[model samples]
Structures are given as C-alpha cells and as structure tokens.
Target chain A: MPGDVNLWPKLTGGEVIDLLASLHGRLDRARKAELLERFDLDPTKRTRTCSKGNRHKVALVAALAGDVELLVLDEPTSGLDPLMELTFQQCITEAASGIANLVVTPPTLEELFVHHYDGAPARAGAASTSGGAR
Target chain B: MTTLTRSRESGPHAAPSSSTALTGTRRLLRFGLRRDRVRIPAWALSIGGLIAYFGAAIPAVYPDAAAMQTRAEIVRDPSGAFMTGPGYGLDDYTPGVMIANEVLGMIAVAVALMSILLVVRHTRAEEEAGRVDLVRAGAVGRRAPLTAALVLLLVANLAIAAVLLAAVLLAALLVNDLALPDSAAIAAGAAVVGLVLGSLAAVTAQLSEHARTASGTAGGLLGLAYVLRGVGDAAQPGGSTLSWMSPIGWAQQTRAFVDLRWWPLLVGVGVAALLLTASFGLVGHRDVGAGLLPARRGRPAASRDCSAPRV
Candidate 1:
C-alpha cells in the first residue's frame, strides 16, 4: 500500500475491502469487522462519496485484515486523522507480533517510534526494532 | 512466542512456482462480471431492442413486393449507401434483407461502441486509477487482470449475440417471417464485430497511458472504419476494395440476408486474434501503470513560483 491509493469507486467500502482481501488469498473477516469499527468507516458507503480519511481506512483495512506473508506500507496513513492514525498504529503493532513481516516507510516510522519504542530508538533505528523484516 | 511457533510450524514458504501466470483469471473474471452485471445487461438489451424494434417496424413500412422495391430503390441511392451496408440484397429486398442492410450498420456501430467502452473500462481504467496495483500486489497473477477483462468481454459479446438472435427470431415469428439461418447470421455478424472492435480496444489500452486516450483511439479507429466502408460502399454499390480495408466492412460483407457469406467473418476472427495476441504481448513487456507510448516528460527544474520562499 502507498500514500495515495484507489479502489473501485462504484463499490461500497465493504465490497472493496472484501475483494482486495480475498485477492490476497484469504480474508480475515473478524479482523476486517474489528478494523472497520475501529476506523469508524461506514462499510455500506460507496468509496466515491467517502472522505480521503475514510478511503484511506478502506485501503488500510483491506491490507491489514489479510494474513499475508509481507505488508509493505509507504506513507500509509497520510490521509488519516489523529484518531484513525492511532487506530492504524494499534493495528500495525498487533500485526508485528503475527507471522507476517512488516515494512513501513517514514513518517509512519517516526510516529510509531514516538508511540511504540518509549522514544528510545532514533528515527533511523526504529523500524528494525518494531518487528519482523527481511 | 506463540506467533513465532506458529510460523515455524508452517515452515518455509516456497517460491510461487506452483501457481501459473494465469492463476487468478477465473476469479478476476467472476468478479469483473459481477461488477458489470447491471451494465452488461443494459448494453445487451438496448442494442438488441433496436434490432427488435426495427425488425417489427420494417415490415409495416414496406408491406408488399412493390413497396419493398420502392424502399430498395431509395436504399440504393448514394446517401442511403453511405449510411447503411454495401446495398446488399436490395433488389430482392425482404424485411429480413432490410434489417440486414439498413439496421446492421446501426447495430454494428452500437455494438462496437459498447465493446470498446466495456473493455477500456475494465482494463486500462482500472490500471490508470491504481486499483490494479492493489489487486496485483495480492495473490493475483501478472496476466490475470488483462485475461479476465478480455474473457469478460467475450462473455458479454456472446450474451449480446444471444439476445440479438432471440430478438430477431422473435420478430420473425411474429411479423417479418424471415428465415432462421439468415437471422442467426445477423446476430453472429454483430457479435463478430463486437469481438473485433473489443479486441482492438484491448490493443489500444496497451498503447495509451490514459483510459480516455485508449478509448478515444479505439473509437477513432471505429469511425475511420465506418467512413471507409461507407465511402467504399457508396462508390461501388456491391462494395469496392476500400470497403474490405475496414473491419466493419468485413462484417458487412458477410451479406447476411442476401448471399450470407461466412468467409468475411473468418477474416474478422483472424484480425481479432492478431489484436489479442498483440495486447498480451504488450502486457508482458510494459510496466504496470505505464503504456507502450512514452508519457510526456516533466521539466527538470521547478517553476519560479515553486522556488520562491513563503513568508
């Protein structure tokens, strides 16, 4: 996932989430539901009508709700508000302990460093300490 | 520890050689069809409805042999020849021949437009919007989206053919009393045109960076085809060599209700196959979100407005 992403505008948020997650092999429905709730995204709303933050949440949920081998997120939370940004951090933190390898580019790394590492590691050193990475 | 243990239990993930390049085509095709369910039916019915409407109406307009001959004379005129077919079967013109001559040009144009729009919508539009990147990053294969799009088009065109066949057959049963085989030829001819034009869209999608450009290129070609055929048909009533230059002309040369030639359609099929092959080749060579045609290069330096510091 990148900073600016797009899903089919004609599809509802839930349908977009489901389609992308299934394409990744298997969708974690429970995770999808929980993420949808956490992000306050209206699953029934078509993506074209969604705000930028809401659209980011849709892409975020689709990427994070699948049990894939690797998650590469670049500027993934650019459109998110403070609240949803925290929700995103929480989801990624939980995902770090799972089997998948997580690689997130800065400034997400800067945000995560402040929140996750008790402000110990420098910005350059932070992501490696966070989780599994190749 | 539990997550690490579970990861170990699953062992090393092997390279994805197990899955072929076309692995997710069927799923993508299914989803593509589901996405366009409403759209496909609307295109099919409206185009077929035109055939049905005209099929019933043409008989009323020319009720007897004398009346049919009168209509045929007008059709044989240069303006009518420009608008319609190569003036096929105008001498013996039945209601069936009228539909084939007068109506098939309109039908072919409509079908070609539908096919081009549909193919570009699914293929290049998806890629341009960056939605394709999202899907491609998943378990999907490299070729799947393009394959799925072409396959969906094939299914859609087939459905259009079936609807057209029924529309013509039903009209025949009720009023026109046209022969079954000739009516089938009408439906089949339109479907071949759809496939040929749709395949051209697939090729154009690879040529241009933007969806609008892709569709415009294909549509432009179609217009050129129409003009070429019209001019050729008008110049020589039975059709000159210029008519054969266009795909539309090839389909028209099938001469559905009069002579009902099948070889011209084979030529259409051959050209479509060549276009499809070219499209697939383009897909294999180009980077995702890029076209074979080079995009406009950007300026190296920022503009003065951008270089100025804000207060």
Candidate 2:
C-alpha cells in the first residue's frame, strides 16, 4: 500500500506490490503473502476503496516489511487491535536494535517508555526536548 | 525496524517490477465521458433545438424576398444599426442568410460557454475533489488528466456540431424551402464558431483557480468577442477589423447561405487548436487544482459587509 492517500488514485494493487518489492526486496514477497493470507486481499478483484483502518494496515505493512533507516510513526498504533499493536511494537523494537532510529508517538507516556527504560515514565505534563530515556 | 536495517544493508534503491503501466489518459477519458454523457448531450440538444426553432420562425415573419429586404432595411436604419450591424447587406438578404447573421453571434457565445463549463468541471473539479492527485500518483503523467479532459470536450463539441447541423438543415428545409447544401453549410459554420468559443473557454478555465472564476472569465471574453464583432459588423471600412478579432466574427464572415465563404471557418478551427495547445502548456506548468493565477486570501476575521451591525 502506498503511504499517502493521495497516491491511491494512481496505484493499482500490482503497482503497489511492485513498489513495495522495490523498497524491501524479497521481504516484500513474504509480506504480500502474509497480507493476502491475513487480510484476504484478492489480486484479481478491483482495488478496493478501503476505510482508514484498512489504509493504516497497508501503511503499517509497508513500513514494517522494509529495512528502513528511519521510522517516524505518528500514532502508529491507532486502529490496530491488541494483537496487531504488539506485532507493531515488536517490529519497532527489532528495527531499533538493528540501528534504525524509531521515533514513535504513543498517546500515553507509560506506553512510550514501557519496558524500554529502567527509570520512571516521563511526567505527563512535562516539556522535555532532550529525547531523554525515562 | 528489521526491514529498514535489511534495506540499508542491501541497498537504498532496488529495481521495481517490470509490470505494464496503464495509460492514465485512457482511463480518465472513459471516466470523464461517463460523467458528462447526460449533461453534454442535454446542453447540445437544448441549444440546437432553440436555434432551429427560431430559424424556422424567421421565414414566416419575413415571408418573401421583399419582406426580407424590408426587414433588412429596418435593421440597417441608423437607430437599428446602432443596435444591430450596418444595413448595407439588407439588399442582399435571404431568409436563410438573415437568420444566420442575426443569431450566429449569440449561438457562438452559448456554444463557447458550454465548452468552458464542461472542460472546467472535468479538469479543475477533479483536482479540487482530490481525484487528480490520487490518479497522478499511480503511473500517470502530469498532463494526462488535462489532455483526457480536452479530448472528451472535443468529442462532445463534435457531437454538438453534428446535432446542430442536422437541426438547422431540417428546419431550413421545412420552413424556408432553402437549398440543402446552403442550409448544411450554414449549420456547419455555426458549429465551427461554437467549437472555437468552447476552446477559448477551455483555455481560460485552465488559467483560473476556481471553476466559477474560469466560467466568468470565459463568459466575459465571449461577451467582449460579441461586442467587438457586433460593432465591426455595423461599422464600415476598417471598423469591420474588430469582427476579424473575434471567433464569432469568423462564423459571421462565412456569410452562410448568402455567399457561403467556407474558408473563414478554418480560422475558427485554427484558433481552437491554438487555444487548446495553450491550455495543455498551462496545465504542465501548474500543480493540479491550482491555476496560473493565485487565489486571493481574505482577512481571517469577518468584515462589516459580511456581518451587519445589529441594533
């Protein structure tokens, strides 16, 4: 799936698959297979006009399936189920460990710092620009 | 995250799959045609029927050649000339020619306005609705949608021309016992004028940001063209040069059914092509949904005109 909704009019599923393949290589193939298995998106069907959540899945899959240098997620967990949220968190952590800078904005500080930091979570009302680990 | 690391290690850029790319233009044209099918035909039929009905009525009011001449004399009277055009041609009037000359300018205006609205609705409207942006992202070039919209308009105009020609000839034959060839030629000439005006409107639509502004601009230009042609037709010698400035004038100069100078129609076709080309060029230089002219920003707060001061 293309990241931008503006790109929807231009892209067919095949074109999207090709683009994903270009960005992520063999992983794109596996990713596509996984998506087809999970989401049941039939290639033969006309490109479906998806809801925001479905669109988000496309973006999430594209992001998680690729070896990107910088992952900047603005509320990435939105519209994801608990299972999918955990899957997304795992993907982010794995990427972060692999030298990719993961900058994710969660709705709550507890969620942002959970299990990642040894210290207390950053205060909710605090204005901190230092990118400090809580 | 793992994927990003892998991609970085592998290479930043990878080869894309060699799938066939769809032409954005073909798809857009199909979509546009579907959208305008009812609207365009309705416009063409309504306008053409109106012209045919009026054309048929013309011969009844001025029943003979002498009556036609008297009507011409009345038209050429200084006061009438001020309202219409120069009266010198009244002596040469036929019912067919009189009808052609009287209504051609206004018909051209109507045709042009129709063309402008159709093109603007297809192009700028799509852009405003975010459809163009979506289509462009897929393998479509910047010019494809614009080109497709123009092509659709051209097809619509041609259909309009055909309908108009048939209606005009049928009315002329039934009402005035006019020669078939002459009636056909006059109808064709009127169609040519309409196409030219429509092309002008199409170009103007591309130049303006909003549909309303584009329509207004095209309408204004058409009005100007009519006035120029009208004054030129009324005046003598070099004054008629103003008519030459307008596409409407080109149609009138055809003198359809009177002398039927067919060559002047070439001018309309040539101008239409030129204007359409200009529109294409303009489309290339601007972003979709934006016009060559910038939209004016208004004040953040309401003004006195917007909000009446209550007691």
Candidate 3:
C-alpha cells in the first residue's frame, strides 16, 4: 500500500490522476480539473519532480476525487496544512450521503475533554497516545 | 449495523465506463502503454532487427543455386531441423525460401518469448507489485487489465510483423530476387506466432500469483513446443503429423516460402482466440492478486532461513 505511491514515477501527474479518477466513477472532465486545481498540483509535472506533499495529493485526489461508495482512510491528513486538512474533512462531509467513511485516528485531548463517554465501545485506557489501541 | 459500501457491477457509481466487466479496458491499455514505452519497443526492435539481419545475410553468403544447395543439405540434418525450421524449402535452392528454412524456427521462438514476457510483465507483474489493486478498487472492471495487456501485445506483434515484412522484402530485392509473397508469408508467421504465445501467456498468468512463476509456466510450454516441433519436422521431412501438436510446429506448417499455406495461420488465430476466452473466464472467478491455484499458507514463525546466520 505504501509502496504504490512511487509507482511509475515517470508518469505525468495528469495521467496518474486520470487513471485513478476512472477507477471509482466517471465524473465529468470539469470536476477532475477542479479537483486538481484545488490540490494546487501541477498536472504536467512528472511525478518524480513533485514534492512529497504533492505526491500525497496525487494519491489523495485519486482516492477522494471519485464517487466511490466507501472512503477508508488511515492517517490521510498527516501531511496537509490546517486549512487543507479542513478542506479534506469538508470533502468527506459532502460525500456523507449514503457513503461510509472509516477514519482511523489516534485519540486527541480535545475529544477526551469536550465529549462525554458513558460506556463507549472503546475502553478509556485504550486511548493512550503513546501506544494507541489501533 | 451498516457495512462500508462495495460497488457492484451495477451500482449508483456505475456509469457507461464501469457498466461491464471490461469497461475500463481501453484506459488500462493506455496506462500500460505509457508505462512500457521503452520496454515494448526494445523487445519489438530486437526481434525485427534479427529478422532483417538474417534476411540480408543469407543471400550474401550463398551467391548461387549450387552454394544454396550445399547450404540446404547442411541444414537438412535432424540437428539442422531442430535449430532452424522443418527444412521445407531448403531443397528449393532459392535465397528467399532458404532464408525461411534457415531462420524461421529460431525467429518463431524469439517472438514467442517476446510475447510471453510482455504479457506476464503487464499482468501478473502488476498484480505482484500491488498496483492493480488500487486500479481495481476504482471504477475499473475485473477483466480490464488482462484484456488490455493482451490487446497491447496484439498490436505490438502486428507492428513487428509489418517491420519484418518490409525487412525481408527489401533484402530479397537487394539480392535481385524479389519474392514478395514469400516474404509476406514469413512475416505473417512471425506475427501469428507472437499472438499464439501472447494467448498462452494470458493463460499462464492465471495459473500462479507470482510473475516469475507465470513466466516459468509459459516459458516451459514454449520450450516444449520448440522441442516437439523440431522432432516432428526431423522425423517427417515434408511436414510432420507430430508438429501439429505444438504452436511452433503449426507455424512451421505455414511453409512461408515453400507453398504459403494459410490454413496453419488460421489455426493459430483460432487457438489464440480459444486461450484468450479461457483467460477471461478464469480471471472472473479468481480473486485479485491470486491465481487459479490457491496460495499455500506459510509457517507461523520463520524457519531455518529466518534465523540469523552463524557468526
């Protein structure tokens, strides 16, 4: 899974995006163009020349840009800035209709204090950040 | 409780693109071609270049019918048949036919090897690398990749055929003996042999999950074909009943310069079509990244090889 990010490093970003977008649904050409612009990734640049974050964008665009039934993400927002993370989160929310999103993340301090948990499925001790239960 | 959505062959996400199992074949083929820009060309050129070299060199070395006759006798032995072709037109004493007799068998094997490697590289190799999984998870259909790989190979083989035809014709003309029909038949033989091997490769790719295993399976069959055809041609001089069994043997039956038999080429096309249909069937039932033969589980812990070597 991790290794495929660098697959076909010579392919242009646009080509990679096109291939990935076709995997999920046949969104119109304009929608794909919008997605690429939103990510601020250069479509003509070879993948080998793209930055790490942009490479992530390529994979992220492939995954989230399509009309897929389920979006399963693990550490999807690790490298994005605060604004892009929110944009990423908003994209998921927009697809919330009949779509299942499984987002796996470590427990945060804000969640521990802001929310009340009375018999939550996960035991409280499993929330330790040093070694997350997940 | 609701489960995460899995898109079916027919689903809300389905469009004209993902409507069937082969919906994304063209896209996958394009993607495959982009990835293999250098690879396919190199293989095709090598085969074509060899054909050209043989076509040009044969006439230069054997200047007259008497020299050609001597060359024919030398290649009529069992070892000669095994190395070259069935020696069908070796006795004909013409440079055009002699080239076919001297070079076609080896050329057939070369093209077959080319097609086999190309198929396995695109199919099982992609699966082994885990790239196809990502492609599969998208709106792509199950059979698209296999179909695309075969299609790419078919195009490549045809291109090579055209190149060889041109090469042989030019060589025949340069030697002041223009045999267009003979050259065309030999070029067709090379092209169809590739198609046959490409089909066999598709079948082999489904037999094992690993690309190497798939390659080995297909390569073994190619070797067996070569041996059988060689033996058959040696045993039966004009054409052997034994050669009927091997794909290579059938190619020899094309009799490129001797008689230009088109029936064997048709049989090759038929066999290729049959194998391709079977591949589509086998692919539909197997899981992604797996072969028809189930993968065996490994030991819970590493065995002797897993331990560190002694200091």
On DockQ, the candidate that comes out on top is 1
Instruction: Put down candidate 1 lDDT per residue, A17-61, tens digits, no spaces.
Output: 998898887898998999888989899999989887788888889
True contacts kept of 2: 0.01
Per residue, candidate 1 scores C-alpha lDDT tens digits across B82-186 of 888899888788877778887888888889999999999989999999888888878887788999999998999999999999998877665646677788888
Q: Is candidate 1 or candidate 2 better by lDDT?
A: 1
- Candidate 2, residues B1-311, lDDT tens digits: the string is 11111123433434345423334677668767876778889988987898778767876776777887887777665445444542334667765666666665666667777777887777776666554544453445567777787788788878877887777776676665566666666566666766676677667767777777877887788788878876776675212788788777777776666666678789888988998878777776765667777778889998887788867
* Candidate lDDT values, in order: 0.82, 0.63, 0.73
Measured with DockQ on alpha carbons, how good is candidate 1? 0.23
In candidate 2, list every pair of residues with a backbone clash: A9-B134, A10-B134, A10-B138, A66-B3, A66-B4, A67-B3, A67-B4, A68-B4, A95-B1, B86-B234
Residue A112, candidate 1: alpha-carbon lDDT: 49
Kindly provide the TM-score of model 2 when superposed on the true structure, using C-alpha atoms: 0.66
- Chain A TM-score for each of the predictions: 0.81, 0.59, 0.67
Whose lDDT is higher: candidate 1's or candidate 3's? 1
lDDT per residue (tens digit) for residues A1-134 in model 3: 12234545778878777778776665547756777777677888988887766776777777766766655443455566667666665655554534533333313444333433222333433432332222
| Candidate with the larger TM-score of 2 and 3 | 3
TM-score of every candidate: 0.88, 0.66, 0.80
Give the DockQ ranking, best first: 1, 3, 2
Candidates sorted on lDDT, descending: 1, 3, 2
